[model samples]
Target: MVASLSGWLQLRHTSRQLHSRLAPFSTSHASPSPSSSSLPQSTPSPSQSQEKERGAFSKLLLFLPGAITFGLGTWQLFRRQEKIEMLDYRRQRLEMEPVTCTRNNMASSESLEFRRIVCEGDFDEKKSVFVGPRSRSISGVTENGYYVITPLIPRETAPDGVQTPVLVNRGWVPRGWRDKVVSGEEDLDKPSTSSVASNTGDEKTASWWNVWSKKPTSPKAKEIVVPPPVKVVGVIRGSEKPSMFVPPNDPDSGQWFFVDVPMIARACGLPENSIYAEEIEDEHTAGAKNPYPIPKDVNTLIRYSVMPQDHLNYTATWYTLSAAVTFMAVKRIKTKKVRL
Candidate 1:
């Protein structure tokens, strides 16, 4: 009985000792303190903290701009496409229409007509006018030049007796013919201070309107200068401007080659009331030199038969930019974050 009691006492003592040893470890795991529950705090030095803050600011600066730009660009892309499509549709509609100039006529049969009408007329070389000289953007250059204007006299007199052949802007000209010496009653050879003044019987093929004369003059479409008038098939568009300068007796080689109708009428001793048209294709006439001259069709241009492509392209770009800005603003609102 004594041995049994001793053994029992010894076992109890061992159990107590084991429990005492494990108490601290068990308490630490079971009931951690508030501070201990959180992650360890790592405080930077003052200098390090300032450097980190600057780094964060720099990142924000870089990231914000990029994010804004990306958002804006995406918005613009969609809007740009939409506007482009709309213009494309409008351009197509215009081309299908006929060219007509009526006062305040928006969608008239003659408003956007690219072609399909047969203008029965003949080139009035006598009244042919070299219209305003201007620039056309080819490639990236603003090429120096001008267009020749010649009103075609209707073969079949109009009900109102108006010639109505329309103004024809022949082509472009270099900036060399601005002086009176170059443009005289007659100077066939290249512009010169000392050269023979030969009065070539020709006028259209004359020294004036160098560009048009460069290539053979488009022949006057007429089997017999009577009956069967010349036919011009092309689009009817708007006019640029009128020349105001007096028609010099002989403009200088450096003088402008623009036959503004209102201006030219005053000079030609005729009434200012006139119409204008450009010929893309001309019918072959017996009186014409090189009877069948190849036609130059400008319809290949993107905005052909209607508005110009450059203007349309610029408009698209603007709309795209506007859309992009709006989109960026929307995105900024959505992604805005607050500092805690």
Candidate 2:
């Protein structure tokens, strides 16, 4: 296949060379005339002048290469413009939709578009697993740990009859922390921004239970689901924490980053494609884990999340280069015409 393509390319090159040797003449518009001829108030007949002009044009035929090059440049510029516009449109549209945590949405049926969804149910903290993340490690490298994701039972109280429990990616913590998560011993009230601190329970628990807590990964196995249900509002999303370049000193689990949605559901003892959700209220606010504070106008969230690029400036540059080459090629071909 490769050899065939190479041969075809070689043929094309030869054809282009032949065309270049003949193009200047076809594109020429000049005429040949004796500029210094002194006549007795008489000029060549119209047919004679036209014949000379055509002969002069025939002398130019070396410009097809530059024309083809300019055409390709023009095509690239057009493609670049379309891509930039599409990205711009997506950026603008993303603002109206909520920005939820990435781990909230796991594919359920291998067929679904990611979108906003509300789930009603309390978390089964006992069955959750936290994936180790290199993005937030202290050794300047990835460490052994997991991102804690608990299932949230979804319900609808707005007279809408919607109820289901979706998964919630609470946050990340080191490996040993799971066993250390004694209900009464951990303190959740800390103004820290490290990986461990990032996973501390938020406004979900009572004054006592809300404090630093490690909801088990299997609440059913622990027999701990006896309580009022917790309601959650968030968005559905994809999660990924790559371990592509972590030091090998850490446990192999640390190297096992990036949420394989299928693997995650299977580990939960659920079918491989269970659907998940991220919480978000109609009253907009900064997204959880958002580096910046929420803007007063929630309308700007999508714009903030899906930022635009300065590609139009580059597009203009490419178009300008193409136009310049084309113009120069045209001018050169004109210069090649013979004058009589």
Candidate 3:
């Protein structure tokens, strides 16, 4: 019995020594936790980790273009409505009948812009100015020329016979100096003021005034005087000041870029506060027979009809782009989610 106990003790001591050596290794390399062990082990896929890492910044990058497109689409819709209303208003105003413009009704003349009006006047051709580099498209043929602007003195006055003269745009004439002067297939010479017959004492007096002002007559210095004082039909107009893109008027050199009424009035030595008008037509045909044809107001159809009404199309295009972008973003997001 003692030998058996001794053998058992020796065996336990050997087992303890082996256990101590293994315990050091076990402490250094600890076993897994019970909770981790209880769960199924899975190797994380790279794609799933990448999807989880995606932040709000990545989502914003995808949707920003779509948001901008949608905003532009909404803006186009508003512009479309404004354009439609503007076109309608202009069309209605143009179709209305001609009204008589008098000194009594002059207060409301500003509102009469683009409206047809009648007035009795005598043209002060001495103060006429040639506004040039003007081009017109007639029957698909382009005619490059200069516009004659004359001051009209109204016969009727405010109790005092003195009147405020209005500037009148007296139609287009071919460029006199640059090219061969041709009007409707006929070669015409430069307009001569000397040939203009003066019937009235006022005309004779004006001729004297012209001689005095010019001092020495220059061959190039030509003045055109309308023979009769008569009823004039025209449209009241605002100043057509040149846009920023247009070259500035060189009045001293007589190079005109636009129908700047104030500048023309100043250049012509007319009253500075003169209002302007565009004559409907002259009694005589302009060319060899008459150098000046009365200015025709702008054609209503040509002025307003060409306005673009493609806002609806533009809106649709923007919306379509927005929808396409949104669809692509959504599709990509779904693909990512599925991969994850």
Candidate 4:
């Protein structure tokens, strides 16, 4: 009985010792440590909050480009339709009959633009001007050339009996021909000729044969012969507005880059209101030497200057880019939301 009591006492003492050792541990866990209490909670910092806001704003900004591109695509579609309608209207106008141009009737030339007109006139070749260096495709071959613009004195007189002159874009000429015509070298090769009675001449001999058979004349006799007056059939064209990239015309040096009607008229000693016309060749006429000063076909002149296909391509490109960007923006927004 004594041994059993001693063993119980030992067990009781051990339990007390264990409780004393664990008491401090339990209290330590119950109260937070100073370091942990002083530290901040896991809430977002100011910079982090600002970053989240900026992310959302950036995502919204991404949509701006998409919306703008989509709108541009729609605008291009409208542009395409407008181009189609314009081309159709021009085509219809091209099919109309030729109209006789007179000073009284040509006062409103803008309305008559692209319309075929007949003008009886004599060419003032001395005042001819060259506009270049333009390019044209001939039989699938591109050729660099210049346009020959001449003043045409109309046969019909104004109400005050004044002979009004109009500007005529005769056609494209070879680049080399410009210097020849400008320097008067073309007239130097001509032979001096005397007028002969047609009845006295041999029937088989042409009048041109006699002129060419004679010896070349002196430099003083190399004057340009004025051509006889004749009826001119051509299309009326408006003056061109030069783009920023085009070089300005140097009228003093006689270098013309583009056809500015007022400037060209003043340079050629014609009235400011002179009408501009492009001479078209008859379908049955033989091709001229040097394959130029050839006039473009009427159908070609009336066709679209800028093709609608280009706008269609632009529309497709912009819309596709918009869809891609929008999809990316939406995906990014969803990902951000999920993360949040």
Candidate 5:
């Protein structure tokens, strides 16, 4: 009985050793517990979540500039279309025959802008305003000049026996000939007293009045002959709005840059809403020798200030940049996805 008991104990020990050897393999092959498998996967840390949100936000930021540029490009295209339409309208108006411009028909000046018109009037030479220094391209030569703005009184008087006049941009004159034009001189070839004095040094010789007061002699005023009542052919022009870069018109100082219809009318003692017109140069007189006041041609009057080609160029530039940015953004997104 003792031998049988000892043999049974040995068998029990051998079985315990085999069970321990198989325990590691069983654990390795076993499926996860239900509680462990179902537990929420280790939740992303606050830092990791914030990093993911930042990545999305950065991607959006990359598209913002492209979107803005794309919108600007579309706006430019619209502007280009508007410019084209405006130019077409102007061309149509210029093609039509000139209409008679009188007090009766001058009320629709806005519609008549850039349209040629004829008016019978006499110029008020005393109320001439010089606006300068404008630059002109004459026969491929750039010349600095001033525009002479004169008031024209109609042959017919108002009910109150007052002549309501219109403002006319007579034409452009050389910078040195402003006084000659103002003095109603047909010829600018004659040298002025100031020029003679400067050439001959006559200014150094002081007269009795000048020697005592130490002041320069004032030149005698030239007689201005009023032009007879005549017919003027011109295009109706609207009031000019000064750009931010343009300096304000100084009426007190008589320094005029751009044509401000209202301000110029007030300065010249005319009605605030006086009609403004730019004289069209006669084709016959275009080749006249040294024409003091050279009027602008029909083409110049109807030309667009900003060309449509400029807008087209801007549109192309913006669109190209937008496309490039979109391509790069998409590529970056794909790269990130591949890495993830």
Candidate 6:
């Protein structure tokens, strides 16, 4: 009994010592200290803070394109206003009495665009060209035709201060002259000229217009030829730059599309950088009765009357797109608290 009691007491002492050694480890893992839990969190450094600022700045840069577009829209608005003023000026200029052109006044031809002017000049019939496939309005309907642009050598100096010849856009003519189907109708409209003195020696050398009006029964359409020095009243117009869609004038083939003054001058062996005028109505007609082009259609208001003015609409479109993009970008930045 004494040995059993001693052995039991020794085992109990060993168990107590083992429990004492394990107590600290179990308590340490189960519950941390208040000091450790209450300590402040580490704050980001200045460099990290600066990086976040840079990220925001980069997000703002995303609006660069939209800002540029907005600027362009503003510019277009200014252009629109300028065009309106120009139209007003043209209206006033056209209403004024036709100015008698002098070399001094003609010297400033660029400023005289769309202004009515009276010029005395001789038509260089040899240099006359037909610019065609142009559309012409006849009796409220449009038809394909050609414009007769004849170079006029001014008895006076050209407005550009050069004796250089100017091109005169006389007017448009129907291709019916060349088409037999169209000319067939003109034949039916012919009046009996048998009793109208065909015996007159001057009848054989009749003007191209008088002969053309006589129909198929009359002589065939003659080559383009203009009469002598005459007084021309019309608008002084500057040549327009060639358009992307318009085919370039073929000088070699004698085909002209645009009134490219320099090209036409070179092709016609006239002075380069030529100044030109358009004829509104012919004062050289035999009487009040107009002949040559059966229907004389003079387009004095062709350019100024149809100027385009739509900048406001374009500005609104660009602004709307910019606003939408800006709103989306701002919302994204706010929601994500980050830069795109």
TM-score of each: 0.38, 0.38, 0.63, 0.73, 0.71, 0.59
lDDT of 3 by residue, 193-234 (tens): 244434433443445586566455445344456443445566
Q: Best candidate per TM-score, number?
A: 4
Task: Say what the RMSD of model 6 is.
Answer: 10.7
Candidate 4 per-residue C-alpha lDDT over 1-340 given as tens digits, one digit per residue, 9 for 90 to 100: 9999999999999999999999999998899889888988997889999987997788789799899999999999999899999888877877799877766777888899888887766667778889989888879999888998888776553332214577888788877777787777873111233453344445334446646665553444323444445556788888887789999999999999999998999998877878898888874224434455677677777566567898899999999999999999899888978997
Stretches of candidate 2 above 4 Å error? Answer: 1-114, 126-148, 153-165, 170-227, 238-259, 281-309, 321-340
Superposed on all Cα atoms, the candidates' RMSDs to the truth, in angstroms, are 16.0, 26.0, 10.0, 7.7, 11.2, 10.7
Q: What tens digits encode model 2's per-residue C-alpha lDDT throughout 1-340?
A: 9999999999999999999998878766454446644454676788989987885664443344445655665665676667667556545544445333223333242322234444445455555655454234455886555555666543344333223345555554555564354233543221222322223334444346645567633322222223334434444455444456743222234233555555666566665556654334344333334321111222322333222333445545656766676677667656755431
Tens digits of per-residue lDDT for model 6 on 1-340?
9999999999999999999999999999999799988977797889999999998798988787678778878987887788788777777877778766665556767777878877666676556677777786768999887777777666543342224466777776667642432334433111121323243334534556556564443343233333434566777777777669989889888778888877787877876756677777654543424343332334445434334456778888878878877787777678776543
How far does residue 302 in candidate 4 sit from its true spot (Å)?
A: 1.9
Candidate 5 per-residue lDDT, tens place, 1-340, comes to 9999999999999999999999988997796877788878878889999999999999998788789889999999999999999889888987899877655676666777888777666677677888988999879999999998888776653332214488888788887788665566744332122322333324445345557766555563223344435556788898777789989889888789899998999998988888898888875336556666677777887666678999999999999999999888888889999999
Residue pairs in clash, model 4: 172-293
Candidate that beats the other on lDDT, 3 or 4, i.e. the better one: 4
lDDT preference between candidates 3 and 6, better one: 3
**Candidate 2's TM-score:** 0.38
State how far residue 198 of model 2 sits from its true place (Å).
34
Worst ten in a row by lDDT for model 1: 188-197
